[model samples]
Target chain A: MPRATSRATLFEVAAQADVSVSTVSKVLNGRAGVSDETRARIEALLQDHRYQQRSGKRQAAPLLDVLCYEVDSPFGSEVLASIEQSARLQRIGMVLSGATEQATPYAHWVDDVLRRQPVGVVLIACKLSADDRQRLRSRNIPLVMVDPAGTPAPDVPSIGSADWNGGYQATRHLIDLGHTRIGIITGPADMMASTARLSGYRAALDSAGLTGEPELVRPGRFHHADGLEQGRALLSLPDPPTAIFASSDLYALGVYEAARTLGLSIPADLSVVGYDDLSIARWAGPPLTTVHVPLVAMAEQAVHLVMRLNDEPEMAFSRIDIDTTLVVRGSTAARNISK
Target chain B: MPRATSRATLFEVAAQADVSVSTVSKVLNGRAGVSDETRARIEALLQDHRYQQRSGKRQAAPLLDVLCYEVDSPFGSEVLASIEQSARLQRIGMVLSGATEQATPYAHWVDDVLRRQPVGVVLIACKLSADDRQRLRSRNIPLVMVDPAGTPAPDVPSIGSADWNGGYQATRHLIDLGHTRIGIITGPADMMASTARLSGYRAALDSAGLTGEPELVRPGRFHHADGLEQGRALLSLPDPPTAIFASSDLYALGVYEAARTLGLSIPADLSVVGYDDLSIARWAGPPLTTVHVPLVAMAEQAVHLVMRLNDEPEMAFSRIDIDTTLVVRGSTAARNISK
Candidate 1:
């Protein structure tokens, strides 16, 4: 088995061989049907790289399940990219399904997954329903939840950041930049991450002996439009916040939309803070100073956790909370001392 | 069958009933094991909406194959979300496969897909490799290509926008904004879209009676980093362009990154335009004025086309070009007139 940190991926082998990634999977799996010439070449490359079979046993090629709530958002796409990168490194094939992507019956969906026979599954930003959990458990499919939108079931292991800390960090960053009147745009109230982040934001405010004005705290979805809607409402106040903290990068971008619409320049007029520190954060015109949750690391660890659970069911159900940090970028500024 | 533009969605039903999307799917498909009480409630809701089955004859499902270069990028994810949305409304199933996401072999992979028995296939931003095409054909799986990255195989049905027109539109927008020395960042030199877009930019430059400088035209991948690199190069020229046109939104964001790094304010110090009018383009700090390629519509039409081909293989493979429209937003402005 390859080390978890192995950077060499199966996709590289395919690119090197001038063949499809699928061809490399066949050659690695010792599956019959590939022309001997192609198989031999792939084998040689595999041996050169010391790439061993996933295990000594003749198990089917590495296939895993990746489920997402939606596929379009930057957050979803970023996490998917990280997970896919990790899976590719292990030569693991992915069978992707979206909980809301289609209305395929749970029973039928399980039947399909059983046919594919993924070694493990990763569900992102959504909770696994009880019925589906029963079916997956019955099939002995190990699963890990990442950034689950709702709470994870008691027994399931989840890998994610401390949302409370992220919120606290985002708010503190704004406070440190000298903005006492800071507003927050949070995810839906039902989401654990959202409430936790809201708590963190409150915690930060309390620590500074400042009150979090209910009027400035707007709860919204982890989406751009929600950010926009809430941002407009927040900024339209009699005395709008000098700075705002958005719970997610997508939401932060929405806030930017509102800023543009309201003719409020970022930082110079309204310093903004965002979470997720996704690529968008770094590349935004005035790079968004935000909370950096380790999305890629969380995804990689989630995949690893699933694989481990698959091999060893004796493992304890656990929750691993990755730490969040502040990445000070260009989006926030001092309140009284404007640049 | 559901009308393509209908307001009713599976999510709505799931929301109305306050059940999981899977629950709604199970109830709708008449899959074994739905409880009597829950089924009755769901059925009542279904009847209320007059939602009919996708097909009169319930022969399993309308599963179709969706292929892409990779599933992680914004562009790929956007198109996918659109397809998935449409598939959900019509109760169609989608089996997504990415060319570089895993190392599954073409022949063996086909055997797996064949087992699932998808009605048709949608290949996006990737070629229908001859071998895979042959296998899919042998299995009688109809296929449609969308925004193929490479030169599409002749005789294959394809759907895309006129990249040339998009490029022309983007450049003309900059030109009309009084940018005489407008730079452009093209996609890979070998891609059809890249060439067409380049041609369109040239056409616009010719019409404006301003010669496009080779030094100002930079070709890069449809990625943010590429945009950043090319933008820097273009801006560093002794006679830098007053405006820059990026072929894709991701690339356009890269240009935004470079502008910030160089202390240039968008639409003020430097004007930038991008193609693909993806959601990110709108939420950008200074909303990018872009040529909107109808991504969701294209994907919906592609799914429809795939189904049509599956039903009638005798139908000639066709190329459909959706018109591109220019959305005037904040990114472009009259030159040297700071806002």
Candidate 2:
């Protein structure tokens, strides 16, 4: 039997069947075109010769497709690395697509990705919009969104650190330090994490016999430069809050820069805290007191979620919120004389 | 024409051609077993009706794949993000795959990614062995490596910051400041960056009429913890070099921590310079005097190099060397007379 030719190429199959390569591809893809008689013959030959193209095993080890949307932030790269790490562990091939938040339509790109039939997708979902979410849902592709909340898609799962819990704990810690008047420098209003953290801050304030002071709560676009501006604005208030909690470590670092410019010492004149606890937080002039999100754990969870979706196609939407820790550094202190 | 009927469905095509659904699919796909007459007829119909799949536009877009083997490092994320940003500007798709340095048969993953027919691949080439490089070269995939040098596959293109220039510039800056005796903290020996930096240090010493001192140079992994150990080791020497150049910013930070522990002041008892002026360098206590490698530029170049390969597949192997600058901050100075 000529040693049962180890593997059959598409060329060999097309030549043997006296068909064009396009026809073989169509039949293999289960697209409409071949006659019933021809399909039966191809199927019979495939079964007899054990020539299974698009086998479950092949699809199981399919390529990893990645789509990265530009977020104009320093942390975007970190998130991409985390997703890439997870994709590698699954032994999947990867394709990367780049899009901007404004110029590219994510839904169209996602639809294109799905046609390639990748094993799974890791979307750096920092800025996907509502319309994009609807498109993803319509396709029902298995996806794991990092850093941003998925738009309530049935098959798409999301994994991120517990930003709300982190925010709550950070705010509660400030309150526990005897600060009645606190301020917040939030991320963009449209961001889910920003909104969630704001809610947590409100919850903590309410629990501490304090009302939500609208004056103290200001929104910034979550850039270091914005943080600096917001910091200056907060300190300039008639009765500024004793402590400030910035949503991102970079923002908090900006606040530190602002404080430096104003000669207000951290943890002494004004207490400060930050989220994401990026590497810079530890080395900031007087190490920043911030919440440490479990990035590696989040990465692992994202990969697992995507892999599981392959088996449980109808799996319920899952959200994994990894726990965060408060690293008490030199940035925050007990309010000596609070308002 | 019923408003052009919103593109023909499979059912419509089958009905129009007086064929079963499977037969129509087969004929459209040009599979064998269909008589010549049927294939020609189906082709004519498809051409007339313009029944193309939805994925046509997607296939036309540029697709770039990346495989990242390490994600734990702080700089890793930043580089990946930069690449994505650069790729996005060109309207390219990037697939990211993460793998561990310890993984064997690295080429297998590369092959899997190549099967998708990506325009080219950018490998974060850390710790890949000669054998692995050989395997990757054997695949005939258009490849560009980042951060690793001296690849066995000479034909493959690479892009990285001028680690040698960074090191030499840092050492010479210290020398120009009238510091004759200089110490060095080197990164891991096996890393290309480490080696390049070491050569640069040697060149700087030779230029300053100072022979390389083995006693003054200590090998340390490029981490803060190792930097601490190496910093302590350098300080304990009978006659420590007045100025110290640590291969990485993390290592330089470690030196700061060590100096604090030993009651030594920066640029007073000890002068320190670092490489890869990471974000934390400016925020570090008494901001570090370091060599600034244009990380974003390097990443952009890597992406451009890979993308360019798609258009010029036979382009000669290219090596892009980005410039580095000496960011003089508070970390280095003239030798202290008391010391």
Put down candidate 2 lDDT per residue, B43-123, tens digits, no spaces: 555545544332222244456666654443556655666776677666566666665544222544544543455566777
Model 2, A281-308: lDDT tens per residue? 7656567899898777776777778777
Highest-lDDT candidate: 1
Worst 10 residues of 2 chain A by lDDT: A1-10
List the TM values for chain B, per candidate: 0.79, 0.75
lDDT of 1 at A86: 77
Q: lDDT score, residue B274, model 2?
A: 86
Worst 10 residues of 2 chain B by lDDT: B52-61
TM-score of each: 0.73, 0.72
Per-residue error for A97 in candidate 1, Å, reads 3.7
Model 2's DockQ score: 0.18
| Residue-level lDDT tens digits of model 1 in B1-339 | 332212355677678888877887665433445676886676566555645333223334346667676576778888887887676566565656656532223323454454455677788877755755655554456878888766678868999988889989899988888889999998877567788899999999999999988899898878788999999999999878889998888888999889877988788889898899988887787788899999988988898898787666658767898999999888889999542
